[model samples]
Target chain A: MSEMTLVEAINLALARAMEDDPDVIVLGEDVGINGGVFRATAGLQTRFGSERVLDTPLAELLISGLCVGMAAQGLKPIGEIQFMGFLYPCIDQLVNHASRIRNRSQGRLTCPMVLRTPHGAGIRAPEHHSESTEAMLAHIPGLRVVIPSSPERAYGLLLAAIRDPDPVVFLEPTRIYRAAKGEVEDNGEALPLDVAFVLREGRDVTLISWGAMLKETMAAADALAVEGITAEVVDLATLKPYDEVTVLGSVAKTGRCVIVHEATRTGGFGAEIAALIAERSLTSLLAPVARITGYDTVIPMARLEQHMMPSVGRIVTAARKACQFS
Target chain B: MASKKMADGGLPVVARFEVRHRNYLAPDGSINRPLPAFASDANLLVSLYRAMVLLRSFDRKAVALQRTGRLGTYAVSLGQEAVSVGIASAMRSEDVLLPSYRDNGALLWRGVNPEEILLFWGGDERGNHFSGPVEDFPFCVPVGSQAPHAAGVGYAFKLRKEPRVAVCLFGDGATSKGDVYEAMNFAGVHKLPVVFVATNNQWAISVPLRLQTGCETLAQKAIAAGFIGEQVDGSDVVAVRAAAEEAVAAARDGQGPRFIEALAYRLGDHTTSDDASRYRQEAEVQARWREEPIARLRAFLVGQKMWSKAEEERLAAECHERVEAAVERYLATEPRRPETMFDHLYAELPEVYAAQRRELAGEGDV
Candidate 1:
């Protein structure tokens, strides 16, 4: 067991994946010599050699399309898009090629590739550096959108994402890269994807969120506990193929739900979760689902960034409002 | 475009490059250059001609089927049969093909049965599943999108130390897309074992080659990617086959990727839904028909006393029979269940999708 940050945990997972499967390759911009901007691939190039750890040209489209080609030819390629904002150039490859390869080939060709990118805002970075637009990716069928909120989940879920048969967009929350630490065993166990993890058990109301917003949501739950309102906290790790069963069951028991995310409110994944709760567990709900999300505007630069992100106060207020009804 | 290099003892000039064009057959079915050794074999040349003939027949039948409402919209490979057959003939049985939508001739030559290709155009997903080589990708509809996939396949071969090469076929318009440029760049830098063959069919739907790019030749696009570029008279199967053979061999031998621009004209509408008469003139179309691939090959075969009018008639009858059989088989196959749409979406259906799938099944009438 090793206590590591989320970045270290991800690096460990990548190293372990490369060690286990000879077919697994790591490719991206500066993934080799620089060990990635966040050092998520630190020491991988030296440990696995340049053949396995490739530093591709600064072309996101090529990086994505190249990974698809490699995956179809029997190599498990893990491609990294430096940031979530930089993923726009490669959306064509992901949506048209990677996501459709399996269905388009009718199961003959499968893209066993992982596109990893750091998402969310917190670290006062420049424009296009700290944006969380996982909803756009999750909307693409045949793609598994996964985000890790903690070090242990990052290690486990990243390993699972790499091993998944289909293509996966693994969105690593950049805000929590070093904000938190936990003991992630190097035993190489991959946690199950397409399911939500219950971070805290409660009965009054459920706080649903994923990625960096989990920090505020969990804090809200703790704050609600002190107020004698037990709020259950759920981390929806995998956005696509969402574990609706888990969310629905929790909402059915709690009879109240508050969905939170850092993406815009209009088409945010939180709206999907809220809609599912209303559609599937409407009769069991004591109040209408509350969503605490970012405004529909560009994620502002460093100074005004905190105001754009979902705060614990907002989440707690939403949870309290949901609990107040019935 | 022209370039002049002069050394004035400045910082040593970094690079110099050139693009080559190849054509072995003339417009009048006469030889322009010495035939490559493989092209000299009568049996191999006849077999290639036979494939092109069969493709022309299949293409006509497919278009007829579409017009008769027996099949969905079809992309005709008219006037470009030699390009497809040549690229396919150059590929070894083990090498993989990443073909575009119009490369039905190449797909058929690569062992994908005519029925499977028909099924794909017939709006069936199962058509993508090939019973032949399991490694080859299905027909890519998006322009120039499959180029990167070919690069990746080549990268895999290079990584595994495999002798196989990956061949990508697209239209001239694809060279304008960034996908192809990025793929070419990747292939060039990695020196991947891949061949990018572009059939410059003169038209992408309605857009002419002149409007697509300002480059003098489509083959020169490879120069930007740092690879050898060659052009072939696409109407001459002999020339295309020779260039494809050398290119595929070079790739297999780890000489890196080679780009071949086969110049031809689209004789038919881009697809069943298009009306080429709206954009192109008949005089131009009539002139191209005289230079189409099948007739050129027939003239060569007759000149060599290897084929006669009687043999041509017999071959036409045989091609008709083969195409008819494939159509019958395609029409007889049943469509997949609607619920099966959810089947291949993922390796395993998530609970939410499974629930929606159950809902879909519940409405059996749907």
Candidate 2:
């Protein structure tokens, strides 16, 4: 186990994936020579050569479309969209072409490719850099969405996503790249695409979160622990096929829930989890399902981003509100 | 159901005798011109003929399958089977074929297994694509989308200096799409080694010939895109083969891309979802049927003594038997698992989904 930041964890995971699978290729703007703007693919091209680590054209559609052929012809492509907002142009290929290829082929062709996009608002990045629109992706039936919190989880979950036999949208929380550090197990063995990881055990309110905001949830839980509150934290690694069993079981035990994310409260995944908890674990609940989330507004560029992201205070307030419920 | 005379409609009723582009007999089953099988062997001719017959059979079967709810809405290639097969015959073993959804006939000619074809007709992935030396592409359902892929692959060939050419087969309806124009423009500008074969059967779903374009002919559209263009009689296999051969020659000889339009007819329902009678007058269908490629070719072959009536009947019987056996084979195979839906979704599975997949696995195997 080695202590490292999320960015380091991602780089380690990529190194391992590239080492293990000759078919696995990394391609994006600046991903080859510059190791990507975020340095997520640092040393990858150097280690694997420029052929496997491609520096593609800036056109998103071509980047996405080229992967379809490459993957079809037996290459595992990992496409980096740079930011969550930049993924829009490639959505048509992902949603319309990649996701449905297997079904459209009546089970003949499978798009076993992975896409990584940096999501969420926190460090005052430019517009479209920190946006997270996972709900629209949630509506797609065939895609699997994954979001990891700490560097350790990023390495493990990313390895698993890369090995899964479907198209995976690996949503990286750029905000936590430097902030979240943990011991990473860089073993090439990947986990499943539908399991949720439990970060902490508690008998009080259940704290459900993913991506970068998971740090705030943990911080909030620790703060609450000083006040004699026990919180159960669940880090949702994969989003589309979310671990309902883990979440529902925790909700049934804790009997309270607070969903957290950097995305806006309106129509976020928080709403879905909240509704599910309210419907299933309502009888055992000690509080209404609360959510500590960002406001329903566009991600502001720098300077004003502090007002947009859900903070540790927000999670604590939501937890307190949940514990006070009759 | 057709009018006694062709003068009733605004369509030019070009007489077969005056139709200068003949390499086969007229509709009355008499040879009108000598067949130009210059570069082909007898084996290829028989293969092409057999393929054209299978195409007709498969189209009928797919239409029936769609009607019975066994398949999704399909695009049929009924009247233009000869052109599809003849053009496909021109492709070398290493050549790549890019075809629209309506080009099922071409798929058969290109050697996609009949059983696999049936699976595609039944909406199974096993039928979607066959991985083999044939190098044929899966049907392009989005109309003109495959043209760009053809150009891309062709560009790769040019880059690699491979002698192979990419044959892009689409329809007149697809010509109107922006992707088609863009792909052709790129292919021309880049001098990509691509042969653009337009099967101008003259309908964009329900749109008529006039609605397809005001250009005098579909081949003209290719001229504007900076490629040599030619219009040929799609019903005549000899003419289609000659045109395709010439176009492919241009692409192979570093002359870049060329467009060849095979003007033919679409003589069936678009798919099970379509009812042609609702749009076209009964007389129109009958009028189109009079120039059926198969009947004309059969007559021409008989006149030249190269083909026999007994041989034709025997070939039809063999085709029917082979198709039936393929269908039987598909029936024998077990139904695909439902989780195959998840197969190949990603190259790797995340740790988070293990438990859920376990649950799904425990529930029952699809």
Candidate 3:
């Protein structure tokens, strides 16, 4: 076990996978000599060779498209989309092509690679850098979506995703990449890609959150404890095949739920959770299932970002509303 | 199944059906008394003819497999066999081929296993993996998008100082796509050894060649991208072979990319499901069939006395047997389970996915 941050966890997983298979490779902008803007791929190129960790042209479509060719030729590539927002330029290749290659080829070809990027709004990133659009990617078939909340889960899940037979959209919350740290048990243990983790257990209200918002959800849950109301907190590490079993169980017990995320409320993952809760456990609801999410507007270029994006205050308010404080 | 395939997903299998006759031998089983305009040894012409017949026979079998519900809606290269085979035959084994969805003949000419080709188009992702002595790219389905890949492969050849040329094959409609122009420019700027062969069978699904672009020929489109464009009689296999040879040599010698347009008719339904009558006239089809490549070749060969009736019967029997055996072997294999849809993305299955996969396995229980 080793103490690390999400950045280190990803670095470790990349090292291990590349060491294990010659076919596994890494590439993107500034990933080479500069490591990366986040330093997530630091020291990899020197440890391996330049051929394995290349710095490619600024064409995201080509990056996504060429990776399809490389992966088809049996190379396991890890592609880094500079930012979640900037990934738009390559959606045709990623969505119309990459995500459907497996099905379109009738299972003949797949883009069995990983697309990793830093997302969320805490850092005052530019317009195309702060979006947390997991739902957009989760909607695509033939793709597994994951966003680890801690160093431990990041380490395990990264390994599991790297080794998975399907392509994965792995998003890391930039706010927590270095802000949070923890001991990763057994650097070799790989967390599977599809299950959610229960962070804490309680009763009255169920709090569902993931990625960078887990910390805020925990904070809000702890605040609700002072009011003599216990809350169950669940971190949805894997977003695509969300942990409905654990969530439904918690929601059933609590009779009320608050789905929280930094991403916008409209058509966000929070909506899906709310819909699922309404569809499956409507009678168990106390107040309407609440979604504490970002406003349905583009993230500003900083300064007033907190008001634009979701925060612990917003989550706590939503949790209190579900707890009948309204 | 056709409605189901269309109602839910993917690139449509062209459904237009029309057969323009392609005769390698007169009904009398003798080549016409005229000679082919271009010639090599009797053996090479026989080689091209035999390879083309193999693909033609294969196309027939593929359609039967689809009709029997054994295979999926297939995109047949039946009438385009001459262009596909003739172009590929002109190159060396070390040369790379980037073929579009309808170039099964190119795959066969490069020695791809019939099973591999069928398995690929038949709906197996693993079908595109590298195989055999020559490197054939997995099929390019999105129209004309693979042009850059061929250019890139050619660039790799240039970078490594290797002498092999890369040939990119597409249909006439592809000349309009931006990727083609981009690839042409890149090959020209880099002086990479790549040849662009556009099989002008003249329809992008329903839109005819006249509407695809205002240009007289797709080969001319290459000139705008700074490469030489040559137009040839697509039905004339001899012309296609000679044109391919020149393009391949030009690229191999670092003369950069050359575009060759082969004017041929799509002599059959685009695939088994198409009804060409919805668009093209039956009379027009018949007129084009008279200039069919196979018929032209057979006439030329008989005039030279290079081919005989006995050889023709022997080749046809050989082709039929080979296709028959391949079909039996392919169908004899067990059908794959649908769960394979989720298989093989990551090197190993991720934990989160296992829960979902298990939940899906239990269907309706949720």
Candidate 4:
């Protein structure tokens, strides 16, 4: 086991996957000689050779489309978009070809590709750099939307995403790429997808979050412990086809839920979790579900990005409301 | 005017280029140039003629079926048969084809049955499950998107060291899309084994070629991507096949990517949903009918004494019978079960979606 940042873990996972499977290829802008803008793919091209790690031209649509084609031809491709704000161009290829290739071809052709991009706010960056538009991607049917909150999850979940038989949009939280470090064994084991991880178990309330927001959610649980109120923390690793059993089970035990995210409140994924609780676990509820998320307006630039992101204080306040209710 | 000197002295000429057009058989059924070697095979020429006839027969029946409400809105390859048939005929069985909606003729030549084509137009997904040339891509509805797929396939072939080429077919209007340009640029940069065929059908629904772009010819678009681009008289199957064979062979031999722009006219409306008379003149359509691929090939075949009036009638009858049989098979196919929608969505359905599939099957409540 070695202490590694999230980005390093991602690099380690990629190297492990390529070493294991000759059919796996890594391609994106600046992924070859430059080792990617964030250095997530550092030293990959030199180690794996330029053929396995390719530097594509500056076109997101082509990158995604090439992956779909390559995947259809039996090559496992992991494509990267520099940032979430630039992911719009890929939506066309993802929706039209990648997602529905199997359905369209009636099992004749399948798209087993992964598109990775840095997601969410908190990074002091310019416009079109920090975006948490996971909701937009989750809305696409036939796509698996996954977000890893820590170095360990990032390493394990990325391997799982690459091995998945369908297309996956893997959103890596840029804010925590190097913010935290953890011991990640370089084992080639992949964590299961379409499931959630229960980080901290408690009885008073459930603090649900994923991606970079887990930092604040865990902190809120710690803060709530001081106030004599214990909060359960659940990390929804896979946003789409989420682990409803775990979420509903936690809600059933706690009887209260507080969902947090970095995306805007309107039509956010938090609403889906709230509705799930309302439909299945409403009878067990002690208080109405609450959602603490970004405002409906656009995420501001770095100067004001902190206000747009969910903080530990906000998560703790929401958990308090859920606990204090009748 | 005096020439300005550069910082390093005088500017040197960096590149020189030219575009060539091929036409062995003219629209008047006369030879415009020496025929390629393959034209000597009377049996091959006859087969090409038969394929064009079959495509036209299928196209006419498809339009009638759509009009009678038996089929959904369909894209017809009315006058562009030679372009598709020629390209597909040039490709080996191992080659991959990324075709557009109107390339049914190409698919048929590649061994896809007429019944499957009818099934596709009849709004069934099973049609895309091609039993023939299984590696070929299904019909791409979005314009120019398949170009990138072709490049990707070519890249895979190059990476695997496979001596195979990927052929992509699109329309004149698709040349304006950035996707096509980007794909071409990538293929050129990698020298991928890809051949891009642009069927310049002179119309993109209501828009004309003049309105699509200011370029004089679609073939010139390839020059910007650093490759050879040539035009062919699409009405003459001989020229299209010749150009395609050369390009496919060159790409397979690691000579880099090649582009072909086969100029044809959309002798019919864009699709069953379109009415060409609303945007184009009747006189233009009439003039194009004289240059349509099927009749031109038939006229040339008859002149060469390789075909006759009797053979023409017999081939037409055979095509009609074949098409009717396919229509019967298409009509006999039953609708798939509703729950099957979840079957192919993923290799194995996730447990979460199982409830919805069960609900769709009327087995459980969500």
Candidate 5:
């Protein structure tokens, strides 16, 4: 077991996957000699050789399409788009080819590839650098959208994403890439996908979130504990094909749900979770479900970026409202 | 001003490049020059002629089916049969083909059944599950997107040290897409074993070739990627096959990627949904029909005494019979189960989707 940040955990997991499978390849812009902009792929090219860790030309569509073709040819490719803002070009390849290869070919071919990108705002970067549009990706069928909140989940979920038989869009929370650290055992054990992890069990309200919002959600749970309002925090590791059983069960027990996310509120993934609770666990609810998320406006630049992100105060206030209702 | 200075020795010439054009058979079905070695094989030339005939027959029937409201919107390889059939004929069975919607001729030559093609245009997923050349990609509807896929396949072969090559086919309009350029550039950088064939059919839906690109020839577009690009007489099967064979062999021998631009005309509307009369003139279509691939190949075969009038009639009848049989089989296919939509979505359906699949199947409250 080693204490590492989320980015370091990602590097460890990639090294482990490559060491285990010869078919595993890492390719992206600056992934070879530069070791990635965030150093998530540091020392990978030297260790695995330039063939396994390739630095492709600056073309996101080509990178994604390459993964589709390589995956179809039985090579497991993990492609990285530098940022979530630049991942739009890859949506064409992901939606048209990677997401539907198996169904389009009727099981004749499959795309076992992973497209990893740093997601969410709060890094105070330039325009189109900190956007979190997980909802748009989650809307794509035949794709598993995974977001790991901590170093531990990042390590485990990344391994699972690489080994999965279908294509996966693994969104690493850039806000917590270095902010969050945990003891990640390099034992090659992958956390199951399409399942949620119940971080803190409580009875008053369920604080549901994924990715970078988990940090605030956990902090809110701790703050709410001081006010005698115990909150259950559930990390929705995989957005698409999310673990409904765990979410509904948590909502059923708490009877009050507060969904938090950094993405804009309208059409956000939080809306789906809210609807899920409304449909499945409504009768058990003591209060109406609440969603604490970013506004519908564009994520502002550095000086005002913090206002655009979901803070622990907002999560705490929402949880308090959910607990105080009727 | 810059060119004038360069001419006055301000800048020395660093590089010289030229694009080659190949034409084995003239429009009049006469041999224009010495033929390639493959053209000497009478049986092979006859097979190429037969494949073009079969593709034309299949295309006609498909259009008729779409017109009769029996099939979905279909893209026909009407006049460009040589471009696809010729290139496919040169490829080994182990090679991968990333083909566009109009490359049904190539798919057919690669052993995909006519019924499977019909099933695809007929709006069924199972059609893509090709029993022949299973590794080859399905018809790519998006323009120029499959170019990168071919590069990736080539990269895989190179990484695995395999002698196989990947061939990608697209239309003239696809050359303008950034995806195609990026793929070619990447292939050039890596020297991947890839062959890009652009069928210059002179039309992209309602757009014309003049508006599609500013370059004189689409083949020259490949020169920017640091590779050899050649143009071929697309209506002449022998020319296309010879060029494709050379390109495929060069790529397989680790000589880097090669690009071929085959000049043809869209003898039909872009698809059954399109009406060329709105954008193109009838006279142009008529002139192109005289240069269509099937008739040109047939004329050459007949001139060489390798084919006869009776043999022509028999081949046409056989092609019609085969197309009709495929249409019958396609029409007889049963619709897939509604729940099967979730079947191939993944290797194993996640539990989160299981209930939804069950609900779609009308299994209540599972």
Candidate 6:
């Protein structure tokens, strides 16, 4: 096991997947010689050769649509959308063609491609660069939206996403890309997907979060523990096919839940989890579910970004509110 | 006419480009150039004419079905039958076809059964699963989007060193979209085995070709992407087939991507829901009908003495019989259940979707 950052783990995953499968190709803007803007694909082009690692022109629509075609023609293409902001231009390809090809063809054709993009705000990226739009992508069917918060999870989940039979929108949180380091075993093992990971289990209340915001959520859990509050912290790795059983079971046992995310409060994935808890585990709830999320407005600029994003203090407050509810 | 380049001192001209147009058969059923060997064969020419006629019959029946409320809104190939048949007939069975919504004629000629095309436009998903050419894509309703997909397929072929080509068929308006330009650029840079066939049928829904771009011709657009682009008289099946055969052969031989702008006219409305009369003059439509592909091919066939009036009558009756049988089959099939909408949405429906699917069927616990 080697200690690596989230970005390094992602790079390792791509390298391992490429080494194992000759059909796996890496292509995107600046992904070849430049090693990607964030360097997530650093040294891949030289290691794997230009044939497998490609640096395409700055065309997101072509990049996304090309993967759909390649996937249908029996190539496992891993396409990168530089940032979550740049992904808008190619959403048509993902929504109209890539997502519908299998169903439209009645399983005659399937797009086994993985679209990777950095998401969420925290690195103080300019406008359109730091949007946390996983909820928007998760809304689409036939596309799995995954986010990895830690180095280990990033390595395993990215491998699983690449190997998934259907198209997967793997949203890498830019905030935690290199913010932390963890021991990652690059033994070519892929972790399970479509399930939530239980970080620190508690019985009083459940702190549900995923992606970058897992940082603040885990911190809040620690603070709550100092106050003698046992909080169950659940990390939702996959947003679309959410591990509802795990979340519902936690909420049922805890009888209180606080959902936190970096996206807007309105129509964020938090709302979906809240709704599910209310609908299924409502009777077991001793208190109302509280949501700690970004505002409805756009993710603000560098200075005000902190104000717009959900903070550790806010998560703690929401958790306290949930635990103290009548 | 030839274009001359002037020298500026010691500075040299960086690049030069020229667009070529091919027209083997004129509008009055006269030969413009020496016909290709395939065009010279009476049996091959008649088969090409027959395919175009069959598609025309299918188009007419589809429009009638939509008119009588028996089918959903349909896009008719109409005057552009030659473009589709030409490209389809020229393509080998192994070459994948990425067709737009209006390329029903091409799909039909590519061995997709008349019933399958009818079922697709008739609003059924099962029709997308064609019995022939398993690698071909379904009709892309969105404009200009399929080009990159074809490029990607071609990229795969090039990567595998396979002697296969991907044929992307679109309309004039698609050339205006950035996706088309990007696909062309990718194909050019990679030298992928792909052919982009833009059936420039003069209109993109309500927009005319003149409004689509200021580039003298849509064929010139490929030059900007660093590749060869050519134009062909789409009404002339011989020209279209010859151009497509050449282009497809070149791509399969690893000569990189080729772009062909086949000029035709949209004789029918964009769809049954659209009213072309609102946007264009009836005289223009009437004038375009004179250049319709089926009649043009038949005129050439008659001029060659290869197609007699009796043969025309027999072929027309046969086409009608085939179209009517497809219509009957489409009308007899049952619509998919509402709950089935959740099935194709994913390979295996997730638990949340499964609950929703059950809820749709009134069997949900939530």
Better of 1 and 5 by TM-score: 5
- lDDT of residue A16 for candidate 2: 96
Candidate 4, residue B182: Cα displacement in angstroms equals: 1.0
The full ranking of all candidates by TM-score, starting with the best, is 5, 4, 1, 6, 2, 3
Candidate 4, backbone clash total: 0
Q: How good is the docking of model 5, as DockQ?
A: 0.89
lDDT of 6 at B291: 79
Docking verdict class for candidate 4 = high
lDDT of 4 by residue, B140-162 (tens): 99999989889889989999999
lDDT of 4 at A325: 95
> Candidate 1, residues A136-213: lDDT per residue as tens digits?
998999899999999999999999999999999999999899987999999999999998999999999988999889
The iRMS of the candidates, in order, is 0.9, 4.5, 4.8, 0.8, 0.7, 1.0
**Least accurate 10 contiguous residues by lDDT in model 4 chain B:** B1-10
Which one is best on DockQ? Answer: 5
Each prediction's Cα lDDT score? 0.91, 0.77, 0.77, 0.93, 0.94, 0.90
* First chain of candidate 6, TM-score: 0.99
What is the C-alpha lDDT profile of model 4 across A1-326, one tens digit per residue?
99999999999999999999999999999999899998988999999999889999999999998998899889999999999999998888988999899988999999999999999888898899999989888888889999998899999999999999999999999999999689999999999999999999999999999999999999999999999999999999999889999999999999999999989999999999999999999999999999999999899998999998888999999889888899
Better structure of 1 and 4 per lDDT: 4
Most lDDT-accurate candidate: 5
DockQ (C-alpha based) per candidate is 0.85, 0.16, 0.18, 0.83, 0.89, 0.84
Off by over 4 Å in 5: B1-5
Note the chain A TM-score of all models in turn. 0.99, 0.97, 0.96, 0.99, 0.99, 0.99
- Candidate whose TM-score is highest: 5
Model 2 TM-score is: 0.76
Model 6 bad stretches (over 4 Å): B1-12, B361-366
Q: Taking candidate 2, what TM-score does its chain B reach relative to the real chain B?
A: 0.87
Give stretches of model 1 more than 4 Å off.
B5-15, B363-366
Q: What's the TM-score of each model vs. the native?
A: 0.98, 0.76, 0.75, 0.98, 0.99, 0.97
Global CA lDDT computed for model 3 = 0.77
